[model samples]
Target: MGLSHRSAQSHDHWFVTERDELHRSDAIELNGRSALNAAGIDIDDVVYLDLYSCFPSAVQVAVNALGLPLLDPDRPLTVTGGLTFGGGPGNNYGTHALATMTETLRKDPGAVGMVTSNGMFLTKHAVALYSTTPPRDEFRVTSPQLAVNARPRRVPTEHYSGTVQLETFTVRHDQQGLPERAIIVGRTGDGARTWSRSSDQGLMAALETEDLLGHSMRMADGHVEEISAVSREGLF
Candidate 1:
């Protein structure tokens, strides 16, 4: 069964269903599982997946949701390379993904494939499952918002000034392929989250070589001050 976001209008469209069938989740893993359950299938049954590849983290979250290894060489993550390689067509990229998945499932009859789409900074997610064979029962879709709502949310502090641990980050580059700025999301000592940007050329250069996830850093006056790696023993 295929899935898409429901529109506000009450138009009776095949792709746009009831709000209950329209699911939205910030957690990619939960979103993936919810889509699978709605389609009446398991992770093992899906032979193909086209994860939303706007960024690396999006792909990582989907991989985590499917309980797949990070470095699995057997399963290719993308059916059409990826957004960078396959051309990101703004909000309509998922359409291309679904088309590619459809062609793939047609060639490999009886096999199941999944396509994931994201809208607006990983905040919106939609997963669709397809197969050559028809389902025994009528296809049904579900909303995973309840499950996602029940999960704890990280409270963010606007002006946090203290030690923090890096949660995840991304570096933006310019057209010339040079590092431009770093967008960082971190958790303060009190468990509050904070987002900051760093344009320090030296720091950006250092971040390229370091695995900064979970690393300790200090923020002051709304700026990242110092960064340090967390030792294995220290973590324990």
Candidate 2:
């Protein structure tokens, strides 16, 4: 078994994200491929997968990072259905995945399994590998903050007054499953990212059905204008 825990250093999840960062995950501290590499294991040798799937994006990130198709009958992403079909157990979800991996490996000798877990807006990452056969070398546990911290991190612009491109956002719903607010991340003309929020009912409604990315958002002195005129306000 091998385990690698990593950090992006910044607490803000969107500090270095882009429109496709959720899938590409290049800015993430460590991915399953790298973790497997450090363990002297080839990704092609793995036979089981248990990627963290608290959300579809989490699995998408893993799929992109590990070079996998989103849905494959021969190679489903998880031994267990993950948090989607099963209830999320917070960080403890990995325990259920590991137990499933054990059962899977036991069913077929010499099979390999991999598990990936993340939390807190992708700021933290953990990857583990298991094999029915003994590893060629000892498992290495690493927390390489120094290497990760060396990567350049973008600082959020404190103020902006220009046309912003809506990059990505998520609508937060209430107990009744109604969208009450939306969190947004938009990029300036020069590509710097900023965070904002909106509670406009009409806009929130449209966000659920609209492809709002690349829509215009005018911000000046902490005031935000909407996308496609469907929205009229936002907060930083």
RMSD of each: 7.2, 5.2
- How far out, in Å, is residue 107 in model 1? 2.2
- What TM value does model 1 have? 0.74
Predicted candidate 1 versus true structure: per-residue lDDT over 1-236, tens digit per residue: 33232111111112211111112234456666776666666778778878879878778766775686666667688888887787766677777888888788878888888777766545666667788787666665556666665555556577679888776677899999999999877776766678889999877887887777778888996689988866422321
Error of 1 at 60 (Å): 1.9
Best by TM-score: 2
Q: Residue pairs in steric clash, candidate 2?
A: none
Residue range 42-90, candidate 2, lDDT tens digits: 6677778888888888788768766777888887889988877755555
Worst 10 residues of 2 by lDDT: 3-12
The reply for model 1, stretches above 4 Å from the true place, is 1-26, 70-74, 170-182, 198-201, 228-236
